[model samples]
Target: MIANRAEPSMTETSSVWGTADVSSGKGASDENFPVGSLLISKALRPHVHAYYAYARVIDDIADCETLTPEEKLARLNAMEDVLLGKREAITRQDSMSAAVLRASLTRTGVPFETATDLIIAFRDDARGVEYKTWDDLLRYCKYSANPVGRFLIQLHRESLNAFPASDALCTSLQILNHLQDCQGDLIRLKRCYLPSDMLALAGASQEDILAGRTSPRLRRVFNTLLDGVDDLNRQASTLPSHIKDRRFRMECAAIVELAKRLTLRLRREDPLAGRVALKRTDAMHAALAALRGWS
Candidate 1:
């Protein structure tokens, strides 16, 4: 496991959700998503980029500990206020989150309420909260992750009937994220997404997690969790068909390709040390496959 090191400050707190001001030469190449520059219809690209930026910002605020609990809540609320147009403008001093929220709301045409729910989820993170059961985690997913998918779906003007499947896909993705970041969350961030009840059922505990080794008991527990992920993936496979529009179908396919790559990583039998992020080459291959099917 990696040492529990503090997250480095890469941007001003308010801009963590937007592009960082990297010098042209070196680290600028490492940006995730680069959705800003991807070759797509100009009208659609900005909305997609705005949603990604919003999600990125909330994730950074939740993962990074630069703010106190009170401060996190205030920043989140302020961002929601900005989304509602209650604030004149979000200053850099306010929180990068507010700026992202403003951009996200403006670009995607997402309702302020949806962004507010996401902010509430980040507020929950400030307290280091954990769920006690699958239902609890699903409720968390409702606020933490599902809104992003729902917002994107709305941007495409897809039917609401697809929301159930989208919810499943979004929650599955969230679980995959939890699995990938298990080691980092325990050792580096001192947090755990595994429910206490499930840990007890698996013969593991918070202490066992912090110990940084996967015992046979932990393996058994991890396998059970993986079973759940597999089921979710199966359900998610049917989601793309729910979106009849070719572009939205392709987007869902791209997402499925991402889930497929993560599922591949989980096939390994070892104690993880940090996140098992997907390689870009694999994603590109998946995108090509998706495009082929659409064509």
Candidate 2:
């Protein structure tokens, strides 16, 4: 998720997403999946980039610091209106990117509601909401992460039969991101996504999170969460087999591999000390796994 920030100047050309570059540099780097990977057909690349741009812009608004909560809500509402056909575009500055996203949805026949669900999640972020249980966190993933996978699946014309596996894969990736960025989310945004009940079971509190240290209790809590993530990774391992499209199956395999690798790293590394991320070599391994269609 990106915070309030301007797009990077280097991507200002229309090369990246078939629209003006609306990416905040920070957001681009934070994305875990290969947005323009070769595994995706060339025809689908534009739609993928458009979807990513829309998500990036919305996340930036929710995460932006200079804007008040009220302002963020207003901006999100305006974007939602555009997505829902209530308006044409956000502003002259955003019109091209907005048009590209709208066109992609129209061409792919993906429902506007998919994008709106993401808006709902961003609204929660703007309001500084917290999760009380693992179920509550999953509900958040429903809006925040699952829709991206759903939209891509729809774009590929895959059967709805694949959705369950897609959801598991997407949710696992979301959890991996949450675990990796827990420290930053707490320190920078005053947000915590870890379930309160689990923290309590581990004898940890929100204060322990604020202290920015990995105590034994906190480690136990994270280990418990890691177990759940591992389960999801296993569930998602079947996704590639379920996908009918060969290219999409490869892409799914790659994402699952990346998620599995990241989950392993999160299991060992302390989030508070520094960020945990995949190296370029790790990404290459994922790509090769995709090429081989390895689940």
Candidate 3:
């Protein structure tokens, strides 16, 4: 059925994900893939953007402070219904995100299960769940992060052999983001992605995280976590070479380089005192890394 659906026009994709008015969350930015990057084949950009838009809306709903948990769950469920074709899309203004995702699935042959998996993860976030172990957090990344890589691989028609590497890369990126946002996630959402077990090992606790201050114990925890992140980046660095498409290979290389750089920063800096973000120079370095295939 997906194979039979009509491909979406570039115009449609731009209207949904490229419009200036979309919320300014990380999902809305070119964090995953730079817009108009020559590394992506032109035909696939719209579909990629559609996926990004779908993800952005879900993230915004889960993170919205003013919305009750019940409200978030209800909205997420409605999105599931729309994706399943169990309901027509809601009113136009409210439904654009879901509509775009549906179109993307149809046009790109990306499985609906991918989007549904993301919803499951967002639902977990809405429930204010905290991971108890490294394994637990990795499991969460299975739904929250790996699906995006799987979708991109499917879009590119890459071999299944590439999946393991992709999964490692995606999961690592998710953990990197969690480490970077540990303070804000605790302060605003009361959600801690850092494993409780690790915190214990570091002689830290949720109370310390809530205070948004890095104690000596917390610093030790961060350092240990950064080591793990470095290992993940090393594991993921091999993924670019596995990609069959040269351009996509470069893209994959760039992502690995960027993640490596970010992890390095996370290792040295205190997340509570300030934010860690990629600079223009970092972007340039990533681009060069991509070109050189030097993940």
lDDT of 2 at 6: 42
Question: Candidate 2, after superposition: displacement of residue 104 in Å?
Answer: 1.5
CA shift at 210, candidate 3, in angstroms? 4.3
- The number of the candidate with the highest lDDT is 2
User: Weakest 10 consecutive residues, lDDT, candidate 1?
Assistant: 20-29
Tens digits of per-residue lDDT, candidate 2, 3-38, equal 233432223325434333232335466777777677
lDDT of each residue in 167-202, candidate 1, tens digit only: 777888887767766776776656788777788987
Q: What's the true lDDT of residue 169 in model 2?
A: 87
lDDT (CA) per prediction: 0.64, 0.78, 0.78
Task: Select the stronger candidate by TM-score from 2 and 3.
Answer: 3
Flag the better candidate by lDDT, 1 or 2. 2
Q: lDDT order of candidates, best first? A: 2, 3, 1
lDDT digits (tens) for residues 1-295 of candidate 3: 1234343343564565544232325553536335436788988887777777778777877887888899889988887776666666643322466776787787778789888899999999989887998889988999999998888888898887888889988998898888878888877877899899989998899787666557889888888778887888888988887888888888888888888888877777777878777778778989898888733
Question: lDDT value for candidate 1?
Answer: 0.64
- Ordered list by TM-score, greatest first: 3, 2, 1
Instruction: Work out how many backbone clashes candidate 1 has.
Output: 3
Residue pairs whose backbone atoms clash in candidate 2? 3-63, 4-63, 4-64
